[model samples]
Target: MSGKGDCYDNAVMESFFGTLKNEWVHHQQYQSRYQARSDIFKYIEGFYNTVRLHSSLGYMSPNEFEAKYHDNP
Candidate 1:
């Protein structure tokens, strides 16, 4: 939904990928596309979304942030 040639459109994703590369990708050497895909999945689901504390989310992991505000059944 970004306008043509907009500078800020990719900022969020650029930040995400930068974090992914810095925290997870740079240390590993994968042998195949499947291996890379699987490891990234584990990193995102197992650690980033569940355990990583994001400052933008008030130093809470995304799961914690969502649970804090949306605890209604």
Candidate 2:
């Protein structure tokens, strides 16, 4: 956990949301709340975690990183 008023504590989450907005939310238009929710869920599960390459993770997607970690461990 991060201390009070510490940006570092929330840096990871902030980065995630920034990416989500930039790569997904900013490009889409939703007809209803349900549509927005469903689309965002799909984006996170189908693309962000599986396909998006993250620089901090050595240019690997989250799924790839986890798979490699478990395979080696």
Candidate 3:
């Protein structure tokens, strides 16, 4: 476990969740927490991982980046 008040310990994860909520969760309405959870899972696993482009990755999707990296290596 991280020490108390150690913001750096979770900075990357906090940024990810903030982006996830801002880009997807805040724009949707769901009937239940379960439904929201299911949709979020699909968004992250199905769409975001495979399709969404990342500026930090030179506009390549995560899947694309991994494939290119592995193929080149």
Candidate 4:
């Protein structure tokens, strides 16, 4: 990851967090750490993995790609 053209090692994570904040975090004000964690978990599991389309995965959600992989492999 330290080689040439590998400078974007954190690019994927940065992009994910950027999307998280843009689509989820910025719209809400949390009253507690537990509440925020719970809601974020719900968003990630119930919505992000199940429904959000990822361009890097050919526009499939994580669950869809995983299912396809299991079906073929």
Q: Please give the distance, in angstroms, between residue 38's alpha carbon in candidate 2 and its true position after superposition.
A: 0.3
RMSD of each: 2.5, 2.4, 2.1, 3.4
- Candidate 3 residue runs with Cα over 4 Å from true position: none
Give all candidates' CA lDDT scores: 0.94, 0.92, 0.93, 0.90
- C-alpha-based local distance difference test score of model 4: 0.90
- lDDT (Cα, tens digit) per residue for candidate 1, span 1-73: 8897786889989899999999999999999999999999999999998989999999999898889889874
> Which segments of candidate 4 are over 4 A away from where they belong?
1-9
In model 2, the runs with Cα more than 4 Å from the true position are: 1-9
Candidate order by lDDT, decreasing, is 1, 3, 2, 4
Alpha carbon lDDT of residue 22, candidate 1?
A: 100
Span of 10 residues, lowest total lDDT, candidate 1 = 64-73
Better of 2 and 4 by lDDT: 2
Scanning candidate 2 in windows of ten residues, the lowest lDDT window is 1-10
Identify the runs in model 1 with alpha carbons over 4 angstroms from their true place.
1-7, 71-73
Cα shift from native, residue 43, model 1 (Å)? 0.4
Estimate, for each residue in 1-73, the C-alpha lDDT of model 4 and write its tens digit: 4666674877878788889999999999999999999999999899987889999899999889999999999
User: Among these predicted structures, which one has the highest lDDT?
Assistant: 1
